[model samples]
Target: MEQTQGMADETRHPMTGNRLDAEAEASGPGFETHDYDVVVIGAGGAGLRAAIAAHDAGARVAIVCKSLLGKAHTVMAEGGAAAAMGNLWPDDNWKVHFRDTMRGGKMLNNWRMAQVHAQEAPDRVLELEEWGALFDRTPDGLISQRDFGGHRYARLAHVGDRTGLEMIRTLQQRAVALGIDVFMEFTVTELCKADDRIVGAVGYWRETGRFVVFNAPSVVLATGGIGRSFQVTSNSWEYTGDGHALAMRAGASLINMEFVQFHPTGMVWPMSVRGLLVTESVRGDGGILKNSDGERFMFNYIPDFFKAETADSVEEADGWYEDKKNNRRPPELLPRDEVARAINSEVKAGRGTEHGGVYLDIASRRDPEFIRRRLPSMYHQFKELAGVDITQEAMEIGPTCHYVMGGVEVDPDTQQSSVDGLYAAGEVSGGMHGSNRLGGNSLSDLLVFGRRAGECAAENAAKHSNERAAVPDSTATAAADAALAPFAEEGGENPYTIQKDLQDVMHRLVGIIRKREELVTSLTELEELKARAEHLSVEGNRQYNPGWHLAIDLANMLIVSECVATAALEREESRGGHTREDFPMASDEWAQINLVLTYDGESVGLARQPLPVMPDDLKELFD
Candidate 1:
């Protein structure tokens, strides 16, 4: 359904109207007034960059995040930022980088945005360098780069493997120094709009259960991805689709929610952290995938898509480590989806090791000193959690849910949603990665588009005048009442039980390998689970009620899942990360369109829209 663009009908009753007239009711309503030129929600890398940009433009900005300043999920990101920095391989350039990104994304990416991202990514990384990000420096003292999957050259600028930590911390400190007021531990539940223009956001202090409204002319959502909705994931708890859900509920069209990327290397054991990522850097540093029989099995799984570049023999694969041009399948690299499927096939074929995982042997493949030097965090995580030495024993590995390539629909140039005042960036704003996302592209996407969203939103906010359309007192009251509804339900349902069921439904049906029948079944179960969530009960006070908090997050997860499953069912072709057994090939028709999603409260459905065509000058470059 094409969402009609205007202020949605006031679903709540009008008898409780006149909240603005009642502003003098409780010592100025006792509701704190924080008027900012721009407010950025979700302080991950994207939010930080957005806040920084808005502040640099002389906007009074405040960043609201649900977690600590630097402890966001970005800190756990290993691997590196993909950029054509030319620190390691001088032959690399933005044109080749853009082409690689488009090809890796299966061409579903917005061509203009992909072109801009590829061009600007290098500069963003260099900006981080100036902000005191001490990336691993090359022998020439330039920021060092490393090899990652799907890139044609060694173009990922990294600092060991904890480059995300470096990036986030550097940005956080800079944001603080710039005097961007940060409201930590607050979760923005809704985007407030007046006369069809987003004017502010309403949230609550998790510590006090008190409602807070951030009335800003501009808002930027950099709230990251929705990986936590799955059973096995490589994201932090904070990644619960807040940005995606809020935007969708605010009437933004979502695109391509079906393409969730499953990373190829997560620890298979230890049920507690089953999906904790073992970075691709491990393979980049000379590790190889081995089956139970100790045979390097990746060579056997290379398909026609990668045959021109994949190595046919162990000697060639090994030789590629020193000289990349001579070898086919570089030992350090294979596209993420290909590698993940290969591992899954091996495990299913009875090639599994003792721990029900394939061997990721770097100990014998590379020198221990080099292994320890490149991947200190991996060494620590393994030693501390699994009690294994990566230098000696091969790390057991399998696939885990990592990222989603689908999100709120936006113009290829502006990053604006169908809604006029709304803009989305980072992982929450999709269409950049079609079926699969390359390892290093995510950080760069956040940086590139976060800046764009801020700029566009700021420009719109500057020209817009606040109409101050009356917000019914009943509306706010009902929202507050609904927020506290779970506490009112007396033992009708358990929050954890509903959440666990939702997770099981999503994981078992919409998992790494998917089919139409399973996806349909999953949707039915999701509907049932959502019904159960309505009456779910919770224990404890509102302050930090983990059970209640999860219940709220479950709604967002269900909505996101609905969009994903619906889009997956409509998209018959197997392209990039979205594979359907029934329609197992990419079609020419699918090549020209994208799956656009919107919800009408009664039901959510898919809409087909034309793909963004490349600019005239860039078309020849791509060809």
Candidate 2:
């Protein structure tokens, strides 16, 4: 791997002028070693932000990612970042945004995190602008705000539909300008620990198959989500629950694992591209959902929870788009969980389109130029991928596995996990979005919490400035053996086959709608898959081998899938993303509880913890 100019040489530890590991040096040609104050994994929007924060805080930071620097899953985030800037509507503020977030999450969110995110998101968005992010501007030259599902106003600050790309570009440029060391094309397989605290990480280079170790006082996990565990997903190959599994194995607890968000509109035609995302921006810009008979089905499915705020008729709903003060929101703008279930119900009742999905039509509502100007990427995505001209015809869409609301449980303020020195942020950390995340809160969550994680990690490292944790030779050797074990097996289960089976189990059993029997069956199937994965074998040497990578990633996928299914089985009530068909309605008791998962080396264990109570002042907003 190439290091930036001015970076410390890898031959010795930066903090101490000594060889990184004496034992490893004696047993030569095994792995390379480096040292840093803070190591951030994933290199997405969150990782970059965390690295920048740590670097600016006078810490030597290194970012290790499975892919190239800027090709993170954040680039695929088409909708904007949610922040209460109030540029479009003067009534919008942090309180309103916080209330909307908590309501959208079905009151199962970490109230403190929700409050902090809302209060800081505006400042974070403004900071991005100051960092050279060119957001779409309003007529008065303010950053443009757009409407999204579950939000009370036009609050998403965007750059057309490619807001995430711009945010990443800005963060990445800032990190590079700060000269933070980046380890590209590196996959971290294990988090090395000493005295039950994070000390370093170990992983292999994708190009040369050589293992490397980073000895650091603090490590930040921004490794996104577990979407790749499912069959139909918007997440990339890198989202194999690396951070979630790593934290779990490192003796940290994960919260709300059952709450997996199925985005309402994914392309559902041409089997090869069935799960590709059709961004929520389509609906934000006046698109509507229709079933086979061309009925606006979202109208019939508006739940009582949002009845007071949602419009009943088409006229009022349509009018609300242009004049927000006088009219209520349309049912189509309900939270993702609500809309996905509605679409699922429609398909089950035989009202679906020819492709077994519903239609998302904007062609009949807006002008072609308006559509192109607003959703340029979507226009091209449909045209190039499905041969469908979105400006002229409707696009078939269905629910696709999107985001996970569950992740490494952390302190809401510091973003520190249960394990000391092991911090998490972005989609990898839990409790920020609660049971369900709104359309655009992810980008903002990454920035706000990523910065917190980095700054806190830097401070944590500073406390141990005189001390350093060495990567124990035994631990590093064990990790290397486990990583290379797949290549040694002969005539064993194919890693690809096991992964496909695992995805099928998760997609069919523990998917958008779940039941007790299906969830239990999924758990049993997972155990069997886990057994098969133990004997997983690959045909290639590890030099840039995708099969070997998948083989290694399968362990993380199984661990995370088991966490999801186990938590889903325990959370009997229907709430947000974790829908239980057996226990159909949302229960007050369940609402008060958050499912937490832990790993004890071999198996995952679950526990129920009470949700943090909201303060009287914040509760007053809801009342």
Candidate 3:
């Protein structure tokens, strides 16, 4: 937690003193204006990391978020952060982590970013340790490691099952202590740009119906994933693709929007907690998936895809985990995509439980103390939320939309978007996750690239601050008008209904499985939804009006959803998360290029481009 002069003696804007006065309120409360050297548009793990890095680089930084400081969706991340900790497998190294990440993404990850993540993740976790994060410690009083899906070794150093909470708390405390200006409940509706260069952004205060403008040389979009587009998701309400929409509408290209990762285990019963996550660490700690017939069905699904590593028998698989050097069958270590597909298959075959979910049983598989020791949060979540004692009965679980592997396109090294002066990191930026993101890699990606984007943005800001700042007035006005339009319209469409239809269309057509016809229908429906959004009406004054606000957010969700459906329609093959039933096989042609998405108001257009290949020496490095 190093502090720089940029962080010292920071001033806070008094909310009441600078609020809407009578004159400003006459014109619907003119937007509150402020300036910063760098503005980070999310308070999640990535945004926090970016702010920290910018502050460290001697740049004035502020974080604007839709939620309270510590309550971002990152708090719900039960699975641990991935780093080659080597607590369970000493032979594991960065090279192995890189290989696993690339393979997990089906080789669609940017090689350079993947390499950097693998190489730097361990040090980032250690830094967190120094910052007072109390991860579960081993017998030697060192941070303990746990196994997770997709990683070959015990690479996830967690605090039982509350790793995300620990990480966010650690970063949030550091940022607050360093005097980072945090504007909670401020939802950024648009990015302000001047002749193709990013200048700043305009957002509204959620508590009071006040518009606010942040004029900054550099803007970082780290607004996390877009999971709210689905009816059932593992993300919080704030993951509404606001960052993606802001960047795209400001002319930044979004890559890989079609690739969404559906985590294998979410509690499916009692519909209230439908998308609540059941961490993958349970399986890593020796839990097993069983059908209604009470059989370990993972063996049946382990074929050519993971034949080399999967166990042939129960004893072999269990033994392999005990001694990684000699044994072969790493049963619980299968890739997430394969496991998710297997669960879907089992449920489709009438082996599902009462809630169309299969049983995730850990009761008979491991001792109660061991399960309690490693997955304390998992037990508590089930017991508190669902009222099921995991030590007694099997938990009902199904797939839930967990992460979006698509976001603003960025250079592999610099983390700069296609548009200059604009940068992105974390789940809001693409190319690192490719088609499907492995479970624990997102936390690492946030730190690795968030730091890089911050450094790049800070350097660029330093270069430009002395020059006359050109805040885009028209852009700012346009965004502010659009954001406030919903409040002015008369009865036309219900936002909640529109959102439901959009979610239904996405879930039914563009969900876990895809077909060309289904995707085309999804696109058409989304276009209709966009039309409705244009004239959507609300019956409220803007203060804390969720209907009007969501009406605005619905536009972003629809746009990003269209990007996903269109990109998925264009891919024409099954690889990682984007599975097309029409073209059920992965192709070399699709592998050779990445889908690029550009949006027009009426529709989104797609283009194909070759992935930037790493240097020949770097190719050998990946191998």
Query: What lDDT does model 2 reach?
Result: 0.90
**Candidate 3 — number of clashing residue pairs?**
1
Candidate 3 TM-score, true structure as reference: 0.94
Task: Report the Cα lDDT for residue 552, model 1.
Answer: 78
Model 1: lowest-lDDT 10 consecutive positions: 16-25
Per-residue alpha-carbon lDDT of candidate 1 for residues 201-306, written as tens digits (9 for 90 to 100) = 7766565455566667678888888888888888889888888888887888788888888888988877777899999999877788889998888767655655
Name the 10 consecutive residues with the lowest summed lDDT in model 2.
Answer: 16-25
Which of candidates 1 and 3 reaches a greater TM-score? 3
Candidate 3 Cα lDDT to native: 0.83
Report the Cα lDDT for candidate 1. Answer: 0.78
Q: For model 2, how does the per-residue alpha-carbon lDDT over 337-378 read when each residue is reduced to its tens digit?
A: 999999999999999999889999999989999999999999
Q: Residue 432 error for model 1, in Å? A: 1.6
Give the candidate number with the greatest lDDT.
2
Off by over 4 Å in 3: 1-25, 309-327, 621-623
Error (Å) of candidate 1 at residue 534 is: 1.3
TM-score of each: 0.92, 0.94, 0.94
The residue-level lDDT of candidate 3 at 620 comes to: 80
Q: Sort by lDDT, best first: what order? A: 2, 3, 1
